[model samples]
Target: MHRLANPTRFLRLCNMVKPWAMAITLLCLATGLYFSLFKSPPDYQQSDTVRIMYVHVPAAWMAMFCYSAMALSSAAALIWGHLVAQLIAKATAPIGASFTFLALITGSLWGKPMWGTWWVWDARLTSVLILFFLYLGFIVLHDAFDDTSRGARAASILAVVGAVNVPIIKFSVDWWNTLHQPASVVKLDGPAIHSSMLVPLLLMACGYTGFYLWMLIVRMRAEFNSNKIRAIRIRQANR
Candidate 1:
């Protein structure tokens, strides 16, 4: 990690990995979509409407996972003054935000058919909503200051603070009486979901994760180039 901390090295590594990551993301998405749309069986209860879980559950997972990554990177930035960590957190924000939005939209879509409502203030839903706001807040705070370093520091603090919500989002169904269903795929005893449904759901989750990595690497490379250009321009202005 330290060896790849240099921006030039990071850019080179990203260039090398980008094509492979993009390929894998596409492949996984294709296979996953086939499994999700064609191969998977409908839920005994919800019927066709349960199909939304493939997209909604994975997006919700990524939303939490991405924010957790950001928080860890932000902590590294604050404690170790790691520029790459800060860049990673910065690069991950919009992607995480998009995942949160997808989760919310798809959850709402799934809800209307299953729950007979488009929205709810249930603990699970509300916590995920708060997660979305945290992402938005991180973006806004990161750009709010004239001094970029100061802004980054402030955003890092917020990221770390907001991280407390991740676990809440994950366990909200268990912790509170809510409209949301409890865990099906991940549980202490074993997966409650049937193998037929679980396989497609797992594939879709992996696809979403790969997609996030592919986008994150691209965004990080662009951000590194933008910073380099800004530095060069500043040097020219000084000269």
Candidate 2:
């Protein structure tokens, strides 16, 4: 991590990885969609509505994944004073929020047909809603101060603290009576889901992961450039 602290080296690395990330994202999403929409068998109960799982499940997973990334990055920034880590946490906010929003929207759509309702206050649903708000809060807190460093510090602390929600969201269904189903793919034994559905679901997850990585690099690059420009302006004003 420290080795890549140099802005030039970091940017060079981003340039190298960006194209591969994009390629993986495109390939995986295309293949995943094909398998999910065309090849995968429909659920006996949910039927066509089950197709929405491909999108909703992956989006939900990515939402938590992104928040975890942000929390780790924020911790590094606060503990080690790594500017790049700070920028990374900052860059991740909107993307994480976007993923959370996607999850919520898709989940609602899926729920309407399956549960006969558009919303629920079940443990999983409520906790995920809280997670979404946490993302928004992080973004708002980060820009709330005139002193950028102070704002960053405040936001980083919030991120680290809010990370407690991730696990709560994960375990909510297990811990409480809920409309949400228990874990199917990720389990102590093995995936309860059939290979037909599991394969495309896994593919979609990989695609979402690649998309997040690609977007992270792009956003980090933009954030880095913006910081540089801000520094230059400050220097000019001082001069």
Candidate 3:
């Protein structure tokens, strides 16, 4: 871990990882889509509309996963003063926001056909929406100040605080009456979903995770380069 804290060493590791991440992302997404669209049987009740679950459920899962990762990274950055951890938290925000937005849009699309509404203020839906705003807030706060460290600290604080919403989003349906369905795939007894449906869902989830990793490496590399350039400019100016 200490060795990886060095930016050059981290970049070397990322160079090795980026290709594998991209490959896994492509393979999983392709296979998952094929199974989700053709092999898996549609829900008897929702018919063809059930196909939306393949995209929506995985996306919602990724949204929370990414945010949780961001919060943890932020905490690490603050507690240990890890620059790479700070970069990771910064890199993760936009991707997490994208995932959250995707989830909300897909959720609404799925909801329309089943619930007969395009939107709802239910606990699950509302909490996820708050999560989306939290992502945006972090991104904004991180760049709001001219002093970059100050901005980063502010954003990190926000991320750590906003993490409280993750549990709420996850348990919202169980805690309160809501239009959203309760846990079917992550139950204590094990997934209630059939193998046919579960396979593609898991595949898509893996694909999403791979995609995040690929993009995070790319973004972190860019950030490291930018910081290096900025440091050089400051040194030359002083000289």
Which candidate has the top score in TM-score?
2
The C-alpha TM-scores of every prediction are: 0.96, 0.98, 0.97
Model 3 alpha-carbon drift over 4 Å, by segment: none
Q: Give residue 52's lDDT in candidate 1 (0 to 100).
A: 95
Candidate with top lDDT is 3
Worst 10 residues of 1 by lDDT: 1-10
How do these models rank on TM-score, best leading? 2, 3, 1
Report the Cα lDDT for candidate 1.
Answer: 0.91
| Candidate 3 lDDT score at position 71 | 99
Single out the weakest 10-residue window by summed lDDT for candidate 2: 1-10
Q: How many residue pairs collide in each prediction?
A: 0, 0, 0
Candidate 3 per-residue C-alpha lDDT over 93-123 given as tens digits, one digit per residue, 9 for 90 to 100: 9999999999999999999989999999999
TM-score of 3: 0.97
Residue 171 C-alpha lDDT in model 3: 93
TM-score of 2: 0.98
- Sort every candidate by lDDT, greatest first: 3, 2, 1
Q: Write the per-residue lDDT of candidate 1 for residues 1-239, one digit (tens) a residue.
A: 77877877877888888888788778878888898899998888999888899999999999999999999999999998988889999999999999999999999999999999999999999999999999999999999998889999999999999999999988899999999999988799999988888888888888888888899998897888878897998899999
